[model samples]
Target chain A: MDWRWDFTFDVVLPKMWEAAGVTVWATVASFVLALIGGLILMLLKTHRSPWISRPATEFIEFIRATPLLVQIFFLFFLLPDFGITLPPLTTGILAIGIYNSALCAEVYRAGFQAVPKGQWEACIALNLSTYRTFRDVIIPQSLPPIVPALGNYLVAIFKETPLLSFVAVAEIMQISKLIGAEYYRFTEAVTIAGIFFLVMSLIAAFLIRLVENYVKRSILH
Target chain B: MVPRIAIVIGLAAFLAGLSVATFAELKMFLPAILRGAVVTVQISVLSWLVFMAMSLIAGVARAKASGAVLWLAVGYIEVFRGTSLLVILFWLFFVMPEFGLTMSPVLAGVLGIGLNFGAYGAEIARGAIGAVPRGQTEATIALNISPWNRMTRIILPQAIAIMIPGMVNLTIELIKATALVSAVTLVDITYASVQQNQLHFRTVEIFAITLMLYYCFAQFVRFGGDALEERFSRHLSKRV
Candidate 1:
């Protein structure tokens, strides 16, 4: 295989960098939605009794099992048939948020599980209400440890932003495809896009690792 | 928070519109869409079976391999896991032919799904194998069973039991990845949705239906996996 190093520099790098901004925004916006949706779902699952609990649990399970792409398509493509016309970017962000929320819910559940039973008893003995217990006692304690998992999913959702191209969102992958078609250099275009993802993920991971270490140190003291 | 609230309200309104548009599509294309759903199910189930077999093989290789074999297995897993399945499908379908390895669209899609899932599965398999009690392998060795027999009769069944939860999660992932086969032009649910959307310009209706179809199918898989896990663990627990 002939490797054209200069082609990537001249043709692919600048185009992909421009596209990377759009992708990063989509990921961040979607991640915010995910965090909120996931928090709500986790609270629902925990606070509700059997009737509501079962449905919430099942919904989370369903979202967890299905692919994010199908969910995105369903929201973006199918909703308009019934009379909803959203911008492609909005739809892409919504879909990512909903799908990632399901994942975050699972992560929250695991984090909650990791909380020692004594902590719960301590909250109860202090006469804290359930809401206060969760907000003040549980979440603050559980949230820090799950930062790594949350960070991992953030990276995952960023990688998956490429799927948004199917809906014609002009994210990084869409940009790559555009440049590749124009230049007839799929290798350069795709490789540069891949590097963008790799670099971004590495930076995000390092930041998360730093946060995790800081949290650990503070908790120890 | 305000933007997020607006988004939620917007989504609710969108879903309301979807119901109206959905009825419109249903009047003209329900039969065809329902038929396409059947194809979607067929692809999901068949591909899942293949994924399970390949994942098991890949996982076993990952867990048991040493020296160069181990690195090769690790590299295989990393590449497949790292790249988007869409990129891989494009290469498999569009580019492989340039190298004289053309595949039928269905086979190519299945291979893409199988290989992608296999890579993820390998890691899960390694985790499951590591979780198995250490003495189990030693006990088999002491009994003088052939290594293959020992694996088939001893470690695998137990590992399968332990790995059920993870496998169930991966199965759902496979279901989602199948949508990418549309890139190679498989007329699965996503393709069907796109077609209906183009016909009616009611993009939301077709996509909502597609989402529900996948959600229901995924729920069924999760339930079945959990049930099977319960059954397997019961027998193991009883023996202990």
Candidate 2:
């Protein structure tokens, strides 16, 4: 109950807020990468030839089965030995992006599968190019149902951004740790960071639910 | 099937070639890394038990309880689900000591991971419970079964069948999450890999082995879950 208002406001709060912005940026950047990478993975996985799809499947499985922390560490520490050094932020984004692309690939695959076969048949009958069929027909129908699932990953990726701090990315959790180390008062700073995460994630969840409802209603109509 | 086997052999050979290049270094690090893997398994299994207990309580409260109890369950689920596990682990490890509350590294890791994953498991439990047909509950009530009997006998069996697959997925996730315990200084697999890499700078070989070890653990959990699901759902075919 012994809360220091001045320290909370003057020191921890501002630093945490600034770091929160970095957290959001990392999440957004990585999420975008995951989306694009996931789409490619899904397409590659669904390819007719096992030669291509099999490797893609294994790659997805490999990423999914491993921890993001190890992958981040691998990128941060190991890559430099190969003469491919990246900044911590870039490393964070790549690690999270690659890890999440697997999950997102599964979501996208499920979404694509849920699209009715008749739609594809009709496109084929009309002699629509495969590219056109996917771009115009398949993606539109499949994307809506998967919005809620994808939105869940948005929150998931947001929650995971703190892992970037281990690589010295200076996200909110890292800032809290720095403050705690400096002042030897981890309670307030860490609690504040946790509160920020709780609030942001709740807001993100609410927004995702709203989007889910909107997509459902529109599709139904 | 032919192509699948070929691909597997190809991947194995590729990994073997990479390891062979650094065979001596890998041999040096293997024992320490295996020790860390043991710790990873310990944390994962203990935390999974805690997760299941917390989830069951919160999930049942969210489903059947009312008023303050229900709100408390909801609040617990939301807060835990929202926050990062790493932050929670740090808070438990660092902050609690200031309040005259201290825990060992393993204890802090288990509590942090358990509480965080418990929230996700609660949602799965609540959903599975909801998915149980209303007719079964109605039939139990009509039979004048006690409330506890109704839940234990009729409702939970079906709900459990629905819960198994999701729980399996979550278990795999939990295993992967155990890697983060290294952050709190638990000397788990990731920590061991980092240390080995620092010592010899054979990052690729060390981490590749670490990654494979994690994959093996995940596959083990997945197979266990599948077996449990089969056992749980066995009665469905018998009834039919």
Choose the strongest candidate by lDDT. 2
Off by over 4 Å in 1: A1-3, A48-62, A77-86, A126-137, A195-217, B1-27, B98-100, B202-205, B238-240
Candidate 2: residue B123 Cα off by (Å): 0.7
- Model 1: per-residue Cα lDDT over A149-201, one tens digit each: 99888888887899999888888888877776787656656655655665676
lDDT tens digits, residue span B33-79, model 1 = 56667767777777787788877877888898788888888877777
lDDT of each: 0.77, 0.88
Q: Evaluated against the true chain A, what TM-score does chain A of model 2 have?
A: 0.94
lDDT of 1 at A33: 98
lDDT of 2 by residue, A161-185 (tens): 9998888889898898889889988
Docking class of 1: acceptable
Under CAPRI classification, how is model 2 graded? medium
> TM-score of candidate 1 restricted to chain B?
0.85
Local error of candidate 2 at residue B167 (angstroms): 0.2
Candidate of highest TM-score: 2
